[model samples]
Target: MTSTFPILTPAGVRRILLDRKEIALIDVREEDPFAQSHPLWAANFPLSKLELDAWPRIPRRDTPVVVYGEHDGVDLAPRAAQVLRALGYTSVHLLEGGLAGWIAAGGETFRDVNVASKSFGELVESKRHTPSLSAQEVQVLLDAHADAVVVDARRFDEYQTMSIPTATNVPGAELVLRVRELAPDPATRVIVNCAGRTRSIIGAQSLVNAGLPNPVAALRNGTIGWTLAGQKLDRGASRRAPADVTAINRARAQSGARDIAAKAGVRRIAYAELASLDAPGRTVYRFDVRTPDEFAAGHFPGFVSAPGGQLVQETDHNAPVRGARIVLADDDGVRADMSASWLAQMGWEVWVVDPVDAGLRSETGTVGHPAPEAEAVATITPGTLAGWLNDPKENDVAVLDVTASANYVKRHIPGAWFVIRAQLQQALEKIPSARRYVLTCGTSQLARFAAADLKRLTQAEVAVLEGGTQAWIEAKLPLEEGETRLAVPRSDRYRRPYEGTDNATEAMQAYLDWEFGLIAQLERDGTHFFNVV
Candidate 1:
């Protein structure tokens, strides 16, 4: 069954993503490895969390899914296909030759998460010549305590972790909507920044696109640039965006956003009109573009929570079906209006749904989707398993820790074999024989998914650790570290040279150099319709 699966070439997959069609090009390896190298638009769908995530990530069972993995003697695409099929996915296939084949076919590969967003940021800068200031220049403004407001466009937590001295926390989506309030005096210069380039560029440009009067510029390369420039960074800063925007400023932003959106041919849809627009032969994606906290406070039903800033930055991740119609909802029209403008220019048929109407609304957790049911797999808790380990003669349990290689190396249950969830069939040969096989991961979701594979491949009783390794830690059990024993190679993960504490200066510069070249790649591909107002 594995060998008989149909294959998709690298060139074919590239065209699919470039065309913005409904096909999901999935990288089945763990996230860290996928970050090292992969096609520009490919989404990481690790085999570890397939069952728990597949249903929600790829809702339509029949949506074309193409899975691939590391080609270094560890091919997981076939095994991933089996799991997808078991979950009732009608159309599933493999990427021919895997990562190597994609490289061979001359497809553009990018490192790091949110490649599409970063590439778009580069494109926006290339086309619009969005204003920017180097780390040195921004530092000068701050030192002088000039009439300038440095707005960190990253999440509040990231801002608190490390930030440019005296930057306020107005995230990307909120910038245009509340900038006037942040800098009521039009003369106050607004400088936007992120951990790196993408959000900074997008945030600064968002204000420009919205036609803000304040002088705006992105911190040349953000915190990374700031550190590299030998500037001091503030830690544990608690600055936040303005408490409220003035009424006049709100009306101006809403009015300006409407004009910008109109230029992209974006439509304004009433709450009731949403039903009529859900026509046959069209996939309608409903999204609420507000703060994660606000969305959890109160939001309409049947809509996924995608912040406006993140939705635009990771459009392919949020809406893989490129041509699908997208409807964005928000309490204030500014976020929805501003976000829809970007989506429209990106070639989506976009609309804004008024969120003021009282509809069937749900407010609870941050996540929109429910966990998938794994009825076939039995479960055991960390404490019960600890008691079983205490039994001397009845010790017949063989554990397979299917967590990421990095996590496994740090700590794991004593005598557990670290294995990839997809490679369980072959991994069975390497582990010790036992009366029962147990599976585990960071959160136990992957363990549950792997449990089904263990049951199918062997007659031994297979059970998943209920809360996984985290539960074990909380249970106060001892853990063993290092790669002393393993059923799988550590090839599933790729150590990023540009990340971590000890990165060499040249490598950081090289990373930035590569990002600088993405604009040319976009020019060569001619697919991204990045229109700047």
Candidate 2:
């Protein structure tokens, strides 16, 4: 097929990065394959999720976008570019020769997701020489009942999965704010850990940067290290920082975090300054560095809820435009400044919305990306669809679920075939042809987009389920478990070696070794504008 998009060479991309111009280097493949190898700054969009994620992740329609995907004899770049163009993206281009072309040009490639963020963590440790205690040493403190406190810096769910014994779940951004309360005595030893190296290093460094009076150190290599030392981890742990923040502790935290943020050159901006960042040729990302529940209750109208810990751990996914301006917001004085401080050191022109006005938080509930305007497809209610499926005459209608493969396996409408939106056309060959087809997803948002693609492939009457599978379940309809019917291979999520307890000891050690060497990789890449403070 003749290519509709122009080609962008590796040299061209290097120039853009060096010049600090905004560009979205997107890898349009499944996350599992994309995690194996790609450019350091490239974000995984996955062709299957283009419509669902494009508008939110790559906000600007005209932002320079270079896409590439070639794995297992499948070339998805051209197809993805076509989809981008059709979605009104004006400046889409294909990478010259894809990943191989970049390699031939001496461009660096990195393994695993969020390579940029992980590399920066290593850079921070190398420059600052962050303090640490070996897993064996920490275990001794626990066994002797010493006056030491262990805090898990990963997300609560991860801590719940497996954590150090008696460790409180105080995530990265919360370390500065909550640690003083957790370990009240200045003489108390404070230990921070995560599943792997990044969060542990960053979390421990955060306290040191904040000038915490207590002796602070990272659990060397985190839970992975503990397991390697033949130590058992605690499962289903629920220990967490207390909910209430006393006025005195809150004031101390605010003062310390602000000082650190200033040292790192993070700007404290008012709401009025946001408009200036909206100028052409610039991409600005506004995020609320608060917990998901807090955000769901009420949040700044335009800001997305990205908890501070995960935001720093997954910057490439959160803000793909490498040189983009980031504005963070938090009602509490500590989280935004603490998060912004790390972002500033990572070479982002970041700002914290100082004194975030409560009145501006008019929006409430979980906000999804604005639904794109598409040709209206016919809709079928859950009750009516169930009646039709029960009737032999109307059972000819094909039900297609376009939700994530992981979610589909957990629970889905009984007999609904799981399909990848990107593979909808090819998958049609496997699905039996029907007089009419009804598409559904978690909430029918992705399904609505898939309906347009399905229309192009077949003349069959196409419709979307009203409210999708969730509605079916709410209507007291029976749901099926497991992958009962599959139109495409289940390869959406990449399993990380550092997550869970079943990983091989060698794989975990290799992962740590890879991270230990990222500082050298960063130097060779020469495009990362990191300036560790």
Candidate 3:
């Protein structure tokens, strides 16, 4: 029997692009062909891996799914439609004439390996997705003292070099995981931006997808657009309290206090009782809620390094067990208390474990220094860092770069390697250690976190770059930059489709039935799909 869905002309898809409706454009093509070029906003789910775990990643079954492929006998669209329908997707459809038709219809394409990137761009234009205010809008908000949080979703280094004056760095992919920590006030409007559009768009959408209560928007076009509009962007760090710390503390305090617990319907633990849970056999996470640099400078043994803000963002990733006990430690109680509060609300057993004892406080409120050996941790000064360039001695030094991928690609100090903060713990082996280990980022904040983590996991002496790579640069250290292929695995490319004996049977039947019924729906709903013999 013939299918009922109408063949969507290129014009129809174009209109959808302009309208910004919540639809997914899927390109079923091999990786190499897709990397060469594909329409903007289209995501490639190669035919090979389509049957794997593609469906779960797609949040909604009823949401419109448009499928296409290069013009060839491969005819993967129909097969994809079948699998989607069998999996209970109600609105799967094919693109007419596939990519060839899209090009003929004047659609824009990108050279990126993933089609999802292009579709993401299309999502921005179509949804008329609310973008963060321009630099002018920010200026107005500043003048008015409006309750808005401007987040610089770039690498810490980029933020250090230049950013929206009032903006704080929170890296894009990290935001969804960290949103609750970054903006505890449900009333605060959260605005995310990057140096350019991609990360901003992805970051804002991630919050929306996660169903955060806060109103989230992207800074339109980002810093580039802001500067192009003749508006000034913030350069250099501000003296204001770090937004991450502030938000984290607020959330923690609220969660820890009995009154707030009564409101959020959660519980909190005492400091001593929490310490009791730290014994062996239990997977305990002791988090140091200080700037990465400060954490690197020195910290309590066995504490995982997490800047309070990033700790909140990546709590689940770092501490997957919702029931795991978390001990929050910081030089001061401010950040620890704050992070503890949020963790409590998230249903984690949390405590603000003070590094110093109460008796010590009575005698002298001064914190004790780490052991002298800890003080002797080997670190690379700008002057000595150059020696490691070619004939560097293996000093058991571990080097890590915690900056965003894009910035790391732009330029990085020699012998330094990149690791997304979230993935640092998992990828710890990448760093070679012979002497003392040093962690670096665009700023000392990330380095501090990494150094602390190294100390917790190993007995090695650890230090953070004094000011991170930025300080190294200021010291006039030699730098290197060029295309260096990241050996990291692509999470998106790796997927496994659901498989079962009843799967193909049910899938094939659902496929044919959907194809036949789609034509009728097209006439009634005015939706479109591709047609091929």
Model 2, range 1-533, lDDT digits (tens) per residue? 42668999999999999998889999998888889989988999988778767888888889999999985688889988987887778999899999999999999999999899899999988899999999999999999999999999999999999999999999888888889888889999999999989999999999998888899999999999999999989999999898788888888889988998999999988886778779888888999998888898888878999999899999999998778899999998899999999999988999899785688888999877854676688899999889888899897889999898889999998889999887887679899999989999998888998998899999999999999899998899999989999988876778898898899999999999998889889989999999998
lDDT of 1 by residue, 53-164 (tens): 7776676677788888864486878877988898888778788888888888877677877777788788778788999999999988888999999999887877887888
Runs in model 3 lying further than 4 Å from the true structure: 1-137, 142-158, 166-232, 242-275, 278-281, 293-298, 321-323, 331-334, 354-480, 484-533
- The Cα error of candidate 1 at residue 436, in Å, is 4.6
Q: RMSD per prediction, one decimal?
A: 3.3, 2.1, 18.8
Across residues 122-201, which tens digit of lDDT does each residue of candidate 3 receive? Answer: 33334445455665776677678788888776558767666776787775534544556657788898888765554565
Please identify which of the two predictions, 2 or 3, would achieve the higher lDDT against the true structure: 2
Deviation from native of the Cα of residue 270 in model 2, angstroms:
2.3
Cα deviation at 225, candidate 1, in Å, is 0.7
**Distance from true location, Cα of 158 in model 2, Å:** 1.9
Q: Rank the candidates by lDDT, best first.
A: 2, 1, 3
- The weakest ten consecutive residues by lDDT in model 2 span 367-376
Best by lDDT: 2
Runs with alpha carbons beyond 4 Å of true place in candidate 2: 1-3, 391-397, 432-436, 459-461
Candidate closer to the true structure by lDDT (higher is better), 1 or 2: 2
- Per-candidate clashes come to 0, 0, 39
The ten-residue window of minimal lDDT in model 1 covers: 494-503
